[model samples]
Target chain A: MPDVIQIKAFGMIAEAIGSDSLEIENPGTSLALKKQLEAQFPGLKSMKFSLAVDKKMIQEDTDISQGKEIALLPPFSGG
Target chain B: MDRFERQVILPGFGPEGQGKLKQSSVLVIGAGGLGCPVLLYLAAAGVGKIGVVDGDVVSLSNLNRQVLFGEKDLRKNKAETAVRYFQDKYSDIQWEIFPEFITVENAQELILGYDLVIDGSDNFPTRYLVNDACVLMEKPLVFGAIYQHEGQVSVFNHGPNSCNYRDLYPQMPSAKEIPNCSETGVLGVLPGIIGNLMALESIKVLSGFGKPLKNKVLFFNSLTSQTYEVEISANSDSKSSIPETWKDFEQMDYELACEGIKQLSWNEAMKLMGHDVAFVDVREPGELPPLECTGLMKVPFSTLSSQLDRFEDAEEVLFFCQSGIRSQKAAQQLQQVYPDKKIFSIRGGINALKS
Candidate 1:
């Protein structure tokens, strides 16, 4: 049994993901989740954006097995 | 008992801080949503001189967030309007106005004169250009951006090892990838919130009261009421991308750098109707006014990637959204998938088809 994570997308990332948020089986660490998402969305793989878990931008492969809120923040060009 | 008595009472922000603010000059780019508040707060703070650079006009839609203008000021130039408003309220400070867009031709002159540059620009090319200019000129830039319900605030080029916009994200994405305010729409209060933060950073940097958001990017989500502070590490190599020579900087291809996907008019789309091409309706299902064509099919841009197999029969594809913005994004994505195939987005989308 795996924890279900709610991956919330923003701006263009939402357009890439189709839905604002998707519940997916927790793939473990932040890096693993990104790999899972990239595999599901090839377009997302090449897209230049950052992933934030629990409202913090992750630079390292932090763990996310608790199924917390993950936000895909694309660079906002609007003001 | 004076006009500035209220704010001067704060311990850390005393008469000396006020004096520093009264002696500093700040240049604000883009007098739209973010610029309005940044200008207003910096003006009220009694900054010695403030330069406003914008070529946009006040329209009915701007009233929702650009608080400087009222219904009466509609159609007036934003730079001119802002100068008038600030000069009227705070006559102590000098309001410098540049009633034109900051391009590669004029940006250097406009930016270098001011001690601090506050970027409220609305597009990626301008944003990156500003960052490059700030890096080259060694001017501190207070940056802000807004999306639907979220906003980002950062201080770039202000201190040693400080991360500029390019340091965070090195290259500019295609224009089709970014959704401007006109295309995706932004919350009225989001820019205000972020602009105020920008102003706060400017004051902090000017007065030396507190630490500015030098290398950190602040992200805010209005709906969730959540705030995230992302620490951006300075990439020493990022500065290398900025043109070393004036000639190189002048030759930078910003327009081609921010190029959009190819667009097709209704006539062109109609011409391709009889051919073996996939006419994609990127709009969500049940969108009004059905598109009657020989090979029209519904494949919303969002779900299009998942259902690419549906369009396997066609050698080419043409995507159309409600207003043409999303379709451009769809076509750009498909173009990457099938680089050899001809892919286009219908100009003005189905709305143009109606007319």
Candidate 2:
């Protein structure tokens, strides 16, 4: 396995990230994965968001598995 | 057996549920898009008391989603107009009008006595404040947010297993990066779908008839007519983010939390009529409610790139539109191209200045 991860974005996060979903190489942990994403898309460094693995939101460093579905969600202000 | 007889005769909801609804009080935090439909349904359902909190006046551009007010109601305070319009519709229900924004100074006072708080505010600062205030007050909150064709609705701080907004995302994005509805157009019907869901959730919570959205968020994509639910869990860090006391909450800076682009008042914009400032109208030439005073070169926001050379001779540039929202976006675009030049958007646009 290449240890690849599937990514999905919603709302403003999708707006900034262009495509709604993509594949990225895993960085071992959820925290490390976010660092890799910010490096690729610098806009994410300034945004407040959370990462969801297999539909569950993760707050701390967690092991990343191959074929895990990840989602980047931002706080939406629209009423 | 009157106007409410249909719902009163429904399966699970009877006179007792009606009684609970009649006894319940709800405070809706904003009077715009989401607040309008939420207030309408609650009023028609005979919610005992409904309070509305908003400091904005109805501008022309708000007519799309804010169905409560009309042309005659324009320029009137939103909180007052929505309350008064609904007050006469229902005799048994009481409508409370708070013509003010829900600030830290007033959040607790406005939310404490109410049975539940429904957040319909349109900015990050207000959304965060509402979430934190609900958590601190120990009150149930029905949260809803819409972007373009998608909407998210959740019931937070209500049940034992419920999750607050902070639990979902602990940090708030800088306000400068986010766009309001004016800049990023929203489908007019989307808010109705979300706001009505909020009202339904509120009623379910108050009457104890059905399960409200506890510890879960419903994401609806109107474009495809599909809804996806994300099961959320409480985060320990989210709890720590809440201010421990009202004193700390009072010291919080909401403006700095949700800062937008640079803004100038209409009068300040007009003061540059003869100066080195280049007047740029970001709105299309045919857009309604044209500027009362002339001399502004109409460079539609959609075609701003090719027209950048027009302002080469100016020391400063002022952007304005029908309601001032698009102008701020134009200023941001120009700022990127002309980083060294001064740029500002008139705060309320020509609509605010016309009268």
TM-score of chain B of each: 0.75, 0.77
Candidate 2 total steric clashes: 0
Best candidate, lDDT-wise? 2
Location of the lowest summed lDDT over 10 successive residues in candidate 2 chain B: B253-262
Which CAPRI level is candidate 1? acceptable
lDDT (Cα, tens digit) per residue for candidate 1, span B81-198: 9899877787799888998767677888998778899999887777887888888888999999987888888899986777788777765776666667877777788889999999
What's the DockQ of model 1? Answer: 0.39
| lDDT at residue B329 of model 2 (Cα atoms) | 67
Candidate 2 Cα outliers beyond 4 Å, as residue runs: A1-4, A23-27, B258-355
Give all TM-scores, in the order shown.
0.73, 0.79
lDDT of 2 by residue, B218-303 (tens): 88878878776777888988888889899999887654445435566566666766768888878887876676456668899889
DockQ of 2: 0.59
| Candidate 1 chain B: 10-residue stretch with minimal lDDT | B253-262
TM-score of candidate 1 relative to the true fold: 0.73
The clash count of every prediction, one per candidate, is 0, 0
Best by DockQ: 2
